[model samples]
Target chain A: MPKIATREAYGKALVALGEENPDVVVLDADLAKSTKTIEFKKRFPHRFFDLGVAEANMIGTAAGLATAGKIPFCSTFAVFATGRCYDQIRQSVAYPGLPVTIAASHAGITVGEDGASHQAVEDMALMRVLPNMTVFVPADAVETAGAVRAAAEAGGPVYIRLGRSGVPVLHGDDFEFVPGRAVEMRRGLDATIIACGLMVAQALEAVEQLAAEGIEVGVLNVHTLKPLDVQAIVDAAQRTGAIVTAEEHSIIGGLGSAVAETLAEHYPVPMLRVGLRDVFGESGRPDELLQKYGLTADAIVDAVQSLL
Target chain B: MDTEGVVAELAEKARVIRRHIIEMLGEAGSGHPGGSLSAADIVTALYFKEMRLDPTRPDWPDRDRFVLSKGHAAPVLYAALAERGYFPTEELATLRKLGSRLQGHPDMKKLPGVEISTGSLGQGLSVANGMALAARLDGRDYRVYALLGDGEIQEGQVWEAAMAAAYYALENLAVFIDYNGLQIDGPVNEVLAPEPVPEKWRAFGWHVVEIDGHDFRQILAALAEGRHTRGQPTAIVARTVKGKGVSFMENRVDWHGVAPKGDQIVQALKELA
Candidate 1:
């Protein structure tokens, strides 16, 4: 399978949305090239606006456009997109329930050499806590495209988290994206690895590793973190009786926390969360960072094995 | 324009809006009276004459839009919206009440004619710019107006919007900075001054217009100037006294966020009446 960055897929999806929906407009914070919004700019020059490194202003402006019946997609690095403009999102977009899609690229430690300053380990947490926000951490390029289209159609405040580096394709062209539905990658009776974002790729790898070891472990890709697929998570816990959640974010407030809270209430089971554990990431290559932070498939396998 | 007669009429409207502000704030028992009172005239002028609006169709596509960036002054905007018949005047008493459409801040979802939800300072201007940009994109001729407080400029996002509005050359957008001279702490200049206000706006690529915020005619003319200007957003530096109308509250910093109580409300109502 070809490796494609989710940000690249987002740019393509934006152009398609721009063509289909005349009301769709794209706003970026001067990181058009990095966030891959340049393609949208090239195609729909009139519809694209570079807000000049002002993420907060971009959010407020998108809120305004949404007020007047225009669907605006705000693109920026995940760190700046959520942290810098959280109040703007809360006051202008989430509070009013505006149809503004925050396309946040360069999420997680995979931001690599940029170090912890540029990484958004808590972006999903920030967006998920907001009342009207829909959070999506698409696993691969194909899923990213489908997530963008679904977010645009969902028509409220949405946060789509993307990565800077290319990830292996995880889904087919025919894969449909539903807002709060979890896709079951594999079925296992021993344990299950529930993950979101790029970590889903690692979960699949872990499933393969566990299969070789003759330990049946399933993988559930929870793309939407805000309107969490609670039923799927409960079902997974019931089916497997042990679970492990993996994400490219801090274990405190991403997929791990979401799954834990759901299980603690509905179906309590022995589980472990595999991700950054309160420590900040250092500047390194993407592959090296994953290995250093214990965010690799080995980490998922270990967590699942411990849970079982 | 029947200048005296027009001013007299809008002045009456302003007086009524001011009365409503006092009454509502008195009822709410906690609200920003200074900025609300300070912006009553400019807001009154817009709702009464300057902007093209239909009270019946508050969401009309071509109607002019208004955003209260200094959203703590929502009482004044609510007063104007109520007076303009967007909602019933009796609902004025419900400001900040539980489940009231008139929220503590301007909530577009709750209230009619509120173009965008704003309470945090420095965000409304960007929203106005978005509305103006949308108007241009959709081939509509609707204009957008945003009102900012004197101290609201201290927020960094304001300058970001300032740069963006100018860069976009949003001719359909006009903003009013209610230069009320006082914020919560103390006098604006003494507490992190944003002085040379008009010059700063000019430097930011806006067609700067300074006016007495209380003057009905000047407010209208400046808005007209904004309408005539091309290739740049206009900024009207409205010189206003904090807590303008009420004699006791005039230019008083203490009233910045405090609602009038008992005798204060009585005297304020008597003065406006």
Candidate 2:
């Protein structure tokens, strides 16, 4: 079992994409090392830009690059990429449908002791509402690389949420990524647990624990938040009588709300949204933060057990 | 190209653009006629004489890029694109209508020639700076041009972009400040005076060029000088009247975003002719 950080996957994928496509350009707001784009910067200095501590300007520049037929991949902390530069992304990139891939690393509480200010719990909500913007929360390092490749070929504005810490490499090299589609990791008739990002691994763990206790749990990894896999959601709702959604984002207006919205209109079920409560985070270790925020595998197990 | 001939042609085009502005605003029943009319000459010179673009290929890779940072004045950009053959000239009358490509604010997806969708002031300049730097990194020969309203320069982001552009030495970027001295509220001096604007840009390390907004020759020469400029970006501060051709509308802040009435539209058009 090999371990790879999602940020490293982004760097590797960026270099590969740059090699394959001349239009692929990378921009960083002086976080090339933190965001893991330093590798690409070293290899292709002509195709890389260091925009200093100006995230808003970086986003706008990425939009301009897109307008000039250059596919720009901007890397930075998730908080700065989404929170600090929302307007820039909204008007310049998302509004115009520019093919700019905002590779947001250090997403969620897994950003560790850097604390609450660095953790971006609302990036998904902020990006998903904009028209023509695609939001992708890849489950692990392998999937992060796949999502990066998919976004480059998608030909539109995309937000790829990644984490700073090393996560298990669940998806193999051959695992294909299709935008707006969900991947079912397991099949069970009892109930479904929809998850994304770091929580996907926890949900799988919960499913394994639940299986031993004679409770079958269906686990589906939902990567793309906008243009959600509505059909898969309906199918899961029909097959399973209950649903539990887990993510590293805020429970409000995120993966949980997106799932609830889909089910409320079509198939109503006993749904439990497993995510952070309506509160900002503080300084804590990654594992401690996940436990304090109730974003652990044990929490998923408890949530699924309660539905029974 | 002969600079005089280009300026004369652009001057004539500006007249047609003013006529189009009044007609479009009257048809839409509402629009920013003052700023739009003021910006007509600058946009006309860019599309007709400065930019290397094919109307049929709106997304040409190496074509010079133009962004309307002060996006509320889309009529001027629309007029330029319409004259440049981006879409049918007849569609100009349908400005701001439901389902019309020409939106009240520029929408890059709907409109053919729009580079970025902008309406919120003080943001387009940063986007332009990004485009300019991207071109430099790619070693592309194309340049980027952005139009900013003097009133809109109050945004902090504008200065941030100014500093960044100069620091990056983005000489391939050219910015035009339509110094109309009037915003929607009233005279810009009374509202938020942005005087010593050229000095501010120069302090930020830009190659500042002050010129007559309506003088096509000055506009062309300034653009040429901006190209020859090295080690920093250039800002052409063009002094312009709010509503140049229409006697009643000129220098009137009230006309900043107001459409002309039935008789007034005809009068404005006649003056433009």
Candidate 3:
């Protein structure tokens, strides 16, 4: 499978979206190149706005454009896009149910070299708690493109978290995406491994490794974290009787927390979370950081084995 | 647009809006009256004399937009919308009550005429800039007006939008700094003043205008000047008293967010009368 960063696919999808709908406008807070809104800017300069390193104003402006019947896509690093402008998103976008797409890239510990300051490990928690916000953490480039389309069609605020590192494409080009529904990648009787974003690909590796070890485990790719596919999770919990959740975010508030909350309320199961513990990421290569933070396929296998 | 009869009509409308502010705050038992009262004339001019609007078609795409960036003063906006016939005048009593469309802040989804929801300061200018940019993008002729509080500029996002508005050369956008000179903590100047406001907006490439916010002719002329100016958004710095109409509450910081009580409401209504 080819490898492509989700941010790359986001930039391409935005260009295609702009071509399809004239009402689809893109705004960037001076990260046009890194966040990949630069391609959209090149294609539709008239519809593109550079808010110049001002994430709060960019978010508020996106809400304004949404109010005027425009589907505005705002892009920046996850740290600035969410943490820097959380109140702006809450008041101006989510409060009014504006159709503003906040496509934040460089999420998780994988935002290498920038260290803890630039990475956003709690963005999903921040967005999921909002009343009108829909959160999406796509697994790969194909899913990233589909998530962008779904967010554009959605009527309210959406936070699509993308990554900086290139990830293995786990799905085919013709893969169909239905938002808020989990895709069961593999079947197993022992336990279910649920994951989102780039961690899904890593979990696939864990599934294969567990299968080779005379153990069986299922993998559920949960892309939509806000309107979670709770039925799929409950069914997986029933079918497997144990659960392991993995993500490239904080173990405290990201996918692990969401899945834990769901399973605890509906169907309780022995679970192990694999992500960053209550700590911060330092400047390092993406692979080294993943290894150090226990966010790799090996970590998922360890978590599932621990549950057993 | 500022004929003698029209000015007289707007002045009366401002007085009526002020009365509604007092009455609504009195009923709600806890809502902002000072800023709402301070902005009565400017909001009155926009609703009655300046901005183009149709009461029945609140969703008219071509209609001009009014974003109350200083959303704490929502009573003034609700009063203007009601007086403009967007809703029944009697609904003013339901300002902050449960099940009412009028929220404590101007919620665009709940209200018909509200262009965007805002309570957090410093974001309205950005939203207004977005609206203005959208107008240019769609080739629409509608103008976007945003009213920002004097202290709201402290949020830092206001200057960011100020710079972007000028960068985009948004001629159809006009923002008003409701320089009422008072905030909750105390006088705005005494507590982290965003003073030299007009000069700041000017430095950020806005066409600057100063006026007594309570003056009808000055308010109208500034609106006209903004419309006549080209290639940049206009910043109208209106010097205003915090509690403009009520004698005892006027310039009093205590009234900034407090609702008028029994005797206070009666006195405020009498002074307006």
Which pairs of residues clash in candidate 3, taking residues 3 or more apart in a chain or in different chains? none
**Residue pairs in collision within model 1:** none
Worst 10 residues of 1 chain B by lDDT: B109-118
**DockQ of all candidates, in order?**
0.89, 0.67, 0.90
Q: Please give the RMSD of candidate 3 to the true structure.
A: 1.0
What's the lDDT for all of these models?
A: 0.93, 0.90, 0.92
Against the true chain A, what TM-score does chain A of candidate 1 give?
A: 0.99
Judge candidate 1 against the unseen true structure and give its global Cα lDDT, from 0 to 1: 0.93
TM-scores, chain B, all models: 0.98, 0.98, 0.98
TM-score of each: 0.99, 0.96, 0.99
Error of 2 at B183 (Å): 1.9
DockQ of 2: 0.67
> Cα RMSD (Å) per model?
0.9, 1.9, 1.0
Please give the lDDT score at residue B189 for candidate 2: 89
- lDDT, residue A105, model 1: 96
In terms of DockQ, which candidate is stronger, 1 or 3? 3
